[model samples]
Target: MAAPSRNTCGTRERSILDRVPPLLTDLYQFTMAYAYWRAGRHQDSAVFELFFRENPFCGSFSLFAGLNDCLTFLRSFHFTDEDVVFLRSVLPPATDPAFFQFLRGLDCSGVTLHSVPEGTVVFAREPLMEVAGPLAVVQLLETSLLCLVNYASLVCSNAARFRLACGPRRKLLEMGLRRAQGPDGGLTASRYSYIGGFDLTSNVQAGLLFGVPVAGTMAHSYVTSFTSLEEVWPRTLVTVNQDHDPVDLISLTKGWLGRVCELLGAEPGKIHEGELAAFLSYAIAYPQNFLPVIDSYSVTCSGLLNFCAVALALCELGYRPMGVRLDSGDLCKQSVDVRGVLRLCSEHFSISAFDSLIIVGTNNISEQTMVELNTKENEIDVFGVGTHLVTCTKQPSLGCVYKLVEARGRPRMKISEDPEKSTVPGRKAVYRLVDADGHPFLDLLCLALESPPEAGRPLSCHPLGGGSTSLSVTPAQVICLRQEMFTKGQVTQPLSSAAETKAQVQDSLQSLHPRHKRLQEPDSYTVALSETLHTLVTDLRRASTNKSNVVLAN
Candidate 1:
């Protein structure tokens, strides 16, 4: 656990942004950069906002993630010599050699990023990060910025949604690595899911890279690997006892096995011996962290009985078994049944620890399923989430678009046949208005030049205001969401670690109203434009349509 080192560029030594290079963008981006250069607009100053049209999973809120990586990318954004050579070869022979020189010299030294703190709860049509720089350089950044933010925000939002469904009492384990799209996707899911409130991850690499706690258990494959007791040769183990002797743990475990079967109404001869032996081997290997998948044979018939036997034996050796995982069947009923059995064993055997053995529910557990589970009584303590959390099957992608909003200090708008597709023009500043109770009541976006909102005053017309309704609330605190992150080829803002970001998410969630984060029929959080910005939009629309009475909002 050494302190992180910083390079001359001010980026951390081991960062996610190091994995991304300047060339990891679409060909159209390069083409557009070249066109901007060809038209003599390469250095024309432009402002672009990175935002999403809607929250993924139909949820009302999303956590702004991946900002750290974006800043790191800016810190090290320069084309390698090889990249410039390849671009020269790809372009037509008539292409100016000066373009390649420009490419080779390209870096984001002049770029400035203004963004909300990472892990802030964001809404639709609100800017998460704003980039201001030369049009060519900013255009070169569009694809990579969106690529880094979209899925990170989407999966983090998904994980937060699942957390809401499960309640705060249950522990969440990210087990989606095996079911993710690829290695990178899996690793991303692990990192963001933990930041989104997951307690642990099964990806060892994520643990190593992101400082996420890692854990695992014996899978069904391991349970079925043995067919007889003889397979478990050298069946002795050293315990915490100071006797310094290898006790025959297998023999001791077998003694308790018969007792467990008799109490659970299973014939010892008919019980799954291979499964029992596998459990013992796993226990011997990781006595302190033994949590086996107990549904491999039969939860109550053999799996539970064998696990209880091995667990009691471990207790005798002064080792505590972690618990068991329920991977199949009616999870609700089985979880309740398992808890009852544990209660009985704890009371009968005078081993009070058995009463609190963790019961983890797995196997296709969805958000809806969790909602149903919460309605009934169950003893499941942890959720081992897989495909749904990582793959984002409910809503796979977040449409975070990087769009030009202003150029050459003049505000611009993109009016469209679809209002949702239309762009909000200008360099905007974002604010969160908090009430006396410290809950943020609304989010306001205004032109950066307009006076910032005050603690007490009449706020102006809504950006979404097509009608006469206006917000006139006096806030206890008018908090600015924007902070300078990058300038002069360095990250100017202090960055937060994964643990710090996750704590921010927790705090932000608390500050948010519960209605906006509910599992079903969530209340929409307000994101409005200031009076000046609204007036500007109004004039822009009127001029575009040559009509006086038209409004700017849907």
Candidate 2:
């Protein structure tokens, strides 16, 4: 079969879509595209905005993501000849031939778009992106945008949960690749995980793709490959002593660690006199046991006790093996008991063993369970968040929907019995209110050309009123919310790096009022309609309902 010809997005400079996301959307988008053409709505100008009604993972806040993916989707969007031919083969026998003729001329030429800055903090109900163009073009974007946002947001929310639980020591790693849906699923999950606060990932391709730090340790397979667990050390030591070994390795390893003391200009004898001395010596001799596997099968207290003996021996020999790996049972209890054992042994030997014993947990670390374990004093360090983190088990989808907000100098709204589902009517913009401190407090939605009062002034605009301030903003300063992201089809802003995005999420969360951060029954952020929008919605409602009433009265 011949490859389909690509659709050209009407722009002078190429977009990221020129490389990826071209094939990401489902087949139905094309079928819908054909229908729009047949109905003569293909070139009829329209607009749609993307936003979600709630945050995921039951968290107090959410991180904004997937704008890059959205832009890439838009830029790469095109009807390939193969795509067209497939549509031709699938069209019903009775379908109009003229519709297919129109499909042949399809291109994203008449579309105009707008969006929020990617790293900005957002809330429920507000539009993140506005797509205005032909109806067909707007319809085509729905599936792809939601696909990107849903997954990205899920991982971001998950990462935030971990960040909150981890406290000051935020050493997190993404160990979810193998269980992720596909290769890219793992890759993107790691990307957003870092944006949500993880330190690194174990997926090598993901690390290279998004510049995330990749981390891994020897699997049990390495140990099983050797004759015995004892021989595992000598072989590992040989590799550690290879020609490419770092000088730091010499100081940190057993054979040459005495040299580490000398290089640091300290007496080797004195350095070995402390509790950590024995562990350091063993590390130099047998670095393979760094974070040695303990509960490979059963995670019972007896299992931990057996490993505790080996850990004590390594500590006595001056090598603090990395940490104890827990693979099975009652982690909260076992970790506490293991720490107590190490402490007793260190005291008996008159050595510092507390720092030498690190408890690492793998297998079952989802957001909910991690929070539960984090609350305990016996909780383990270094969680391997695999299936749950990668799969986004709690809220697997973002539910990001795009709808038209305005066109040709007129406001519009989507009406629904559910007020929360009701679209904020008009050509509108979102404003974030900040206080005297450079922290965000509330988000205010208003007409694109409207401005609210200054800080300390009465915030008198009803979020849903027309030309009247029904509910004044309760005593907070107003920070202008909207930012210029694109002009015409050209990008006006630079993309935020993963590091910057994570920092933004952290800072934004700190700035939020305590109520917004509550995991349970989080106080909803104040979202009010600008008076104009409220009035417009009210009028539309009255007109539609009144028309029905008139018919009934007749």
What is the per-residue lDDT of model 1 for residues 494-529, given as tens digits with 9 covering 90 to 100?
A: 877778889899999989988888878898888888
Q: What is the C-alpha lDDT of each candidate?
A: 0.86, 0.63
Candidate 2: tens digits of C-alpha lDDT, residues 26-109:
677767777777766677766677888777767556777777666655544666767667667776766677766666665555
Worst 10 residues of 1 by lDDT: 1-10
**Number of clashes recorded per candidate:** 1, 35
Once all C-alphas are superposed, what RMSD does model 2 give against the true structure?
8.4
State the local distance difference test value for candidate 1: 0.86
Which stretches of model 1 miss by more than 4 angstroms? 1-18, 463-469, 546-554
Global fold similarity of model 1 (TM-score): 0.95
